[model samples]
Each structure stands twice: as C-alpha cells, then as structure tokens.
Target: MVVALFNLVSALAGCVLLVVAGGDSVGMPNEWLARTPFPSWAWPGLILGVIVGGTQLVALIAQRRRYVLAWGPHAASGLVMMIWIFVEIAPLLVWSPLHGVYFLTELVQTVLAVLALGAWPQPFFARMPRRSRTGVGNTTDTPA
Candidate 1:
C-alpha cells in the first residue's frame, strides 16, 4: 500500500511535470536539459508517469491480487525508481535531498519485497508435515 501511494504520487507529479513542461516550463528550466539529450522535460515527464509510475502501479495491483511472482514486479519497480533517479541526476549533474529520500525509499521497497519473498530463513508459503516425503517443510524442530 505504501509503495502504491508512492507510485500514485509520483505519477501525479510526473503528469504535473508533463503539463508544466509542455507549457511555459515554469519552475523547471529548459537549461537543465542542455546537457541531456532532451529539448525539455516533456519526454522525461512522460517516461516518469508512464514507465516508472506505470510499472510500480502494476506491481501494487499484482501484489494485491496475489498474482504469481508479484514480488518480481515489486522488485522491478524499485529498480525502475532507483534507475530513474540515477538517470535524472546524471544529466543534471546536481544533487538534491529529495533524491536521497526517494532513492532510499525505493531501496527500502526492494528490500521489503525481498524479505517478504523469504530471502531469509522464513517460509514464504505454508509448511508441509514434518514427516512428509518431499521434506520441504521448516527445519526448526520445535513442536507445533
């Protein structure tokens, strides 16, 4: 839910960026794109809203729906967010506190997904009986 909200806000922000970029390029300066391969923030805004935002939103939905490999999307979305931030700063050649905030957020998102996916010794799914032939249950010897 947190990731979904983040993505939603990002998408809205991106859309706002698109609208602003398409217009007078108000708060955002065209000079920022001078070092990059863009004439304006229009393309970046679109990519943010569509690609970054879209992928995260889809991941959130997949998680909610209990889709198979939902964690994959969650992880992927985090990667996208991190990558977007990296690319965003590369051309600008400057840093902002918000970048650190967002980068950390996405990193946490990815870590949480990995933990939820049982990156540690916790079971991701229900355990079978102790004496089961498959022997895929938890290793702890404590009695149920």
Candidate 2:
C-alpha cells in the first residue's frame, strides 16, 4: 500500500518535472525523447523516477513473499532517499524549487523501512530473515 502510493506520486512527480523542470534533469537529449512538449533533459531523471516508482509498486503487489516488501520498491526507495538525505548531490541538485523532493523521498523511504523492519513477516521484508534460516520457528530445535 505504501509503496504503491509512493510509486503513484513518483510517476506524477516525474510528469511535473518533465513539464516544469524542462531539460535540466531529464538525463536525455531533447532530440532523443522526441517529445518537444517536455523540457527534454529532465527525461532521464524523471523517467528513472517513474520507472523505479512504478516498478516498485508492481513488485509490491505482484510478489507473495513478505520479504519483497522490504527489498523491492521499499528498499529501493529507502536507499535512494537515504542517499538524497545525505548527499543532496542528485541530478536535480541544480533545481532549487524541487530540492524539497529529497526530503519527501526520504520520508517515504523511512516509512517503508519501518514497515519492513518492524512490521513485515519479520526481519528481511525484502531479503531473507535470520530466524527463518536458523530453523528457530520449526520444531527441530534443541531445548536449552
């Protein structure tokens, strides 16, 4: 649910950036995208944002293992947000108006991490949990 919302917002934000930011952060040449309507350079970053967000959302919904929630979109978002929170050196570093995007990304990332680490099926929402590997939940353990 959280990932989905984030992805949706990300996709929309991409559109906004593409249209508003122009070619400043698009990442691709205006001639490449061939859609003069948008700024052009902003395509790379904006497109990437959309792809990551969109895929993350799909991953969240399509997977059965609870771990995916942690490693999939949630993890991706968290990683990017974490970096943005610290570095603030992303492509859009030049854009002042959208600089707030970093904080917003960080927020979603934090939320997802909390859900996976504290909520999910137990440790490793995206990756595997330690207990599951040690067989602690099974009855094959020796009593101390």
Collision count for each candidate, in order: 0, 13
- Global local distance difference test of model 1: 0.78
- For model 2, the superposed segments whose C-alpha errors exceed 4 Å read 16-39, 62-72, 81-97, 118-144
Best by TM-score: 1
lDDT of 2 by residue, 1-144 (tens): 554566557656765776577644655335544433444445545654665455556545544456544445565655554454344334323345344664565566557666655555643434442454667774435332
TM-score of candidate 2 on Cα atoms, chains taken together: 0.42
lDDT score of residue 134 within candidate 1: 68
Model 1 — TM-score against the truth?
0.77
Across residues 4-79, which tens digit of lDDT does each residue of candidate 1 receive?
Answer: 5686587668667675655245455677778888776778788888888888888988988999888888888899
Question: Positional deviation of 16 in candidate 1, in angstroms?
Answer: 2.2
Error of 1 at 116 (Å): 1.3
Question: How much lDDT does each candidate structure score?
Answer: 0.78, 0.53
Report how far off residue 26 is in candidate 2 (Å).
12
